[model samples]
Target: MLRPELIEFSLDNQKAELKIVPNLHGPITEDDLLQLLALPDFSYLCPLHAVITQAVIQVNQLHPQDEGNIELFFEIAERRDAEISFEIASDKMQASMALTAAYGGKSLGLRDVLQNLKLQRISMGLSKAKIEALLVEFATLSPGEKCHSVIANGRAAVNGSPAKLERKVSLARERLLQPQHNSDGTVDMRNLGAIIMVKPGNLLIEKHPATQGVNGYNVYGETLIAKPGKDLKFTAGNGTEFAANNPNQLIATVAGQPVETPSGMQVDDVLQIKNVDVGYGHVDFKGSVLITGDVGEGMVVKSHGDITVMGFVDSATLEAKGDITVSKGVIGRQLKDLSLSTKLIAQGQISAQFVQYSQLKAKGNILVTKQLLHSHTQTQQQLIVSDASARRGDLVGGKAEANKGIKAVAIGATADTKTELFCAMELTELKQQLKQLDQSIKSMVVAGLNIEAQLRKLPPKEQWQADAMMVEQVKVMLEEKRRTVVFRTQEELEFEALKLEIEGYYKHYRIDALKHVFSNVELHVGTAFQRTQREHGPCQISNKNQEIRFDYSH
Candidate 1:
């Protein structure tokens, strides 16, 4: 075990000294001497150690009286100036230096240290007064004694501010005023408040300009470039445009809802359609959509904003970045007819009067007013099926999964349609992911092993005796292979993190059937799952003590 601390260098870098601790860890070998020659700090002294056996002999002869007292006395050369070793901060914002007194010659003056800094390319933020004081302090210290002081500091670069959008009016405040739920826990579907409308020439959004950031220099006088703030442009959709007088001001050209889009703010001018049939091709709009008639089979509607269907939707596909509201029923063919079956995916909340044989997925809540029959619905948030008017909403003959919770007036029917409901159910998905990660990691490990084997066989750049171009190409290839190994290691770290997360994470969720829960209804809560053999009037399903528990409310 040869340590770099055991080796010492002269102040002028002309000679070297080896120290021997009191521990007798066997005699020094050729390999030990070779290891010392390979160190970065001693690479400058490689010309001094040509013979490995001679260097090993020098190390083996160092026998100290005590392990603590291991400093060897070296004969100082004719005239050595004081050694100034710099220590720069990791962030390059501060720099300090330590002075080792000259052995048998004059100490360094202020001019000498300044010339040394110049040679080191440290031209910025020099403290001349501090250097003068440090020179005086160094004079008081004994020869070979060390004194430390701050020499230079650099200013850090300032990051620019991000562009901002200032809104004149807020639709979020109006939504807060309009309550979604009544005192009875039932949703107030009708009193959800009117849409926020903006008049012509009304300023919807105002943009602030981004400013350039100031540049800073390091102790080495190298410029540290600053990152300017991200600039944003107003996204004026239909019925909206930039102001004629001011480009930064976004104003509404017509009356419409002032909807905040992902890019910026926009006036959500609705696009009304009589029907979506074969005659009318797929509808893809940047704004909200309003359909008065039905969306016939094989039709597809996509919008960056919300999609509202006043009439029924039959075997159609509706994809919206915002919410999807269907006034009437959304009917679809069976899952067997995968191509023609209705599918609805929304980033926001989804609300429908009734959904049958359709597939629905939403980031927010999925609200069904009447019934969800044989539909596979999933939501990151809660899923509720309750009709305020009829007081009868059922989830039957399908899979309903939600991360938060699931609430319905009725679950399953007398026919025992094999309905399945899940709350916070992610075990299967996680297991599948683990399987994929395992496969990927195994492949990466094998590939990394092959790369390492190839690297071991290839000669290093220093040892190569090939053409310059060939050596350069080989060096690049080696670096690329090593980078692949590094990437594989990072992916392995991610895989381990996923495993740890799966081990520690537990989903907290519940399922509530306000009315009848018929037989053959399968309920899954977290990791616990069970099926109802007999009908239950009303019950709350949850996981307790790692087991599925059914609490009858009435």
Candidate 2:
């Protein structure tokens, strides 16, 4: 055996050199070697006057006629190899075999010479470590998980076979996963992905708690989402319909391309929400907090602009600098410390049973059955009824200490200082008492006595007479409540008119209303911003109670 193209030469120091110049970076195929070896002019460099002729021993290794041909083949191979400068990367089989057969087939240093070629590649700057990393061959199919895309080789089972290795399909998994093969040709395992691998008759699951079939996997034409809970858990199978698992924490797709975000962005972009539902965690947005769906418990939301919630704000504190508009009623039965801190404009009424310290405002008149619209102690805080509003407040406010009574419907403005005659003073007092009665009626509920808890026995009609007596007492109490309420209202209104005079000094008009805050984070509510007035129907149910008014000058 000889390499017809590789040549043998001697250096100045008389050291022999063997060289081969390969044209392309191709493995030496059998057909290529056959064409070179079949040359009739090949060999003849070696003259074998063997010692086997004298002792008649071991003549089987070399034929006398073939000695010249073998030398000629080596000489031509080495000469051609030197003419070009192709260096050997790997001397797999035929090159090693031919060189050994020509020199001395079982040479002592043959293995060492082959080993030096692998080292020579490293010294030439092509790291064997890198080359070894790139080249890999496997017998079985890949597991096919989506980790990376690397070139793969599927080789023939028989060694030294002329047939080529089958072309391998590039898979997604990082590892070169394979199926298990027994000596008797029994393949008992084949991997589908990291999660599942199968064999001929038995399936060896790679993960525990794994389901056995793909019965519940529902794949839409667009996306395949793994529903892990309930009866949706199923093991993956080998089919075009099934895809290998993608185990990334987040997969975001934008436009038709995927946008890979670098972990978390800056504060300006931390709370980022796209159109898709977050499905699990509290979805946050740096922009206006909008909930297309109902907010679950333990979800806190805050925003700079207004918060528009299409669902209930239950057990959750939704806040914003702009108005908070809740289309649905708030549900917590009673919010003990609820505080709505803006002109809370609601298309729906607040039904949290009772709010301890909460407040709401509408540029339009307020309308709510179980909600109260309280006046602030020190602003020009007054409940005024709009002409469009149908629901009226049982108006009450006064200051007993100042001995001033509130004027209903501007009985006296700052422009006019004169008082009316005392002709209908008695009738006006009775009318005030009746107005107080209405407020009391709005506040109270019919009592329900637990009959089982009745410890003292009394006459049946006695309970009814006692109720009647309580009613009369209530009438007196309401009248007194009205007087006290009116006194406070009058004093506040007088101060409001006075504050307007002071504020007018700094405002556009000689007659003024709004005060100027030198500094503070105060919201600038739109002057024409109208909050909803009715909770039930299309009527304005305003709380024009104290009847405070401060019309602004354009």
Candidate 3:
């Protein structure tokens, strides 16, 4: 029997050694060597079994008693293949790269990794410092451990800003009507309303050009172009012109009030006054009018451009073709019945601090800061009665109409003020215009028929062969009448089409009311009307199925 201690194996089982100790009984034989090798457990070394067996045979043939130990079998360990992987991503603006360390292979140096990356064609945005750090980390990691690191990154381009325009013109002073505090902590109403007047050739606006943006660099060190800034052209409207020296500067041409509009800037011929009282008399200016003081009772102020009153408006009439802005409130005081007899009419918008016992109408929007009490207000667009702070925003009115919508913080008072609100009212003016157009079209059709009948009464062209001069004159007259008939027919067609379009626009009218609505409120949408007996909040009234419906969900 072979002793187990006769052969020795390494920990990894890659090599086997046989001990050649001097035997006390007999010399070692080939069978004894094979038995000793087999006893040491060489199953894991099956791939190298032939070499191991040959080595054992050589050892048996030598049988040197002097040699204490001999290497009987050896096998070189096989390793897993070295693997390298990378992650790359990029967009139009930036790019990035990451690296994953190779596993189960010989230790890699910085140079070796760099060579491998180069051979793999990853030359863009390579960071030497990051590569060195990854190599250092790779050197410290144990076998089968992975090291992942971000290697490269690219920068993004910057976009340019658009050109800006700044207006330097001033209009009426926008002053809040809060009580002024004195040194003794007493409050008083100190009117701060003032009119801003400008002379001719005054600077109205200035334009600043856009700036160029910076370019960017990609991972491959390629230049990325940046979007250039957009330029703006100066729009000088009526009564305004560009400066002679600088095109970016705008200057007023005539001495008037500077008005800023959506299309451009204009200077309206103005009529500036201290007040509209008995001494100053009523005013009806061709252009805009700026009153620095109040319009006393029984006075009128009318303008073609705009009417800007810097003080309170008494029981008077204010009319304008553009807009009407009253710095203070409109009060109809000392009236017999306290009805809203003071009228305010504007083709554009009407903005006021407060309106009480007054009648106001505008083709555009109506913006009130405080409240509308017992007044009648109508607007073609939205009606907004709220400040940014949402304080004193109440609409306890008699009647109000807004074709677009109405927005307020509170609708009625706690006493349940009877407020009548109408939205998307029927386009009566357009409908009337369409009716008149239809009448005109009918009249034109009749006229066209009459002209055709007159043209048909003329002699035929074949009769001209007998009398050339008479035929020529009659033919000219007939041709003129025929042209009139054709033109009238075209006009009739155009008018009919316009009437249809207006009818379609009137059919799709809608309105909405934001915030709370109280009791005793009558709402009218189109031709339908609804009265609320109980208070409903955050509701919207619209015309549906030829009936007024209230929607409280939103």
Tens-place lDDT per residue, model 1, 1-554, is 57776666666655555554433532567676556645665543433334455545544565432442444332212334568888888877778878888754566877788777877777788898888888889988765678988889997888576678888855521332243677899866545444456788899888887666788899988899775655665577677788999888888888766666655666776788988889988899988887767899989999887787767899899998877877678898775545329899998878887899899999988988778999999999899898654367889988888987898999999998899988867756877788888888788778767767866787665777567886776677678777876666555555765686566544335888898889999888887888999888787788776688888844
For model 1, the stretches where C-alpha displacement exceeds 4 angstroms are: 1-197, 200-254, 258-266, 335-340, 427-508
Compare candidates 2 and 3 on TM-score and give the better one.
3
> What is the full ranking by TM-score, best candidate first?
3, 1, 2
- The local lDDT score (0 to 100) that residue 13 gets in candidate 2 is 19
By lDDT: ranked, best first: 1, 3, 2
Clashes of 1: 0
TM-score of each: 0.44, 0.19, 0.50
In model 3, the worst 10-residue window by lDDT is 71-80
Query: Which residue runs of candidate 2 sit more than 4 Å off their true CA positions?
Result: 1-284, 296-298, 333-389, 392-554
Per residue, candidate 3 scores C-alpha lDDT tens digits across 1-554 of 55666556656544555544332312445565555544425422222445545644555555555452433343322233344566656552323333333333344666666776666556556678887787677667544456767676666667565577888865442344343467788654444434555677999888887666687766556677665455555699768899999988889888777765543567888788889999999999887898878999999999877788878898999998777888888887435775566899988788888889899999888888788888888898888787655555789858888887777777877688899888776557667877786777677667667767766877786776579787776777677777766555545545655666555643445444456777887878777887877777766666776697777776
Would you list the clashing residue pairs of candidate 3? none
Name the candidate that leads on TM-score.
Answer: 3
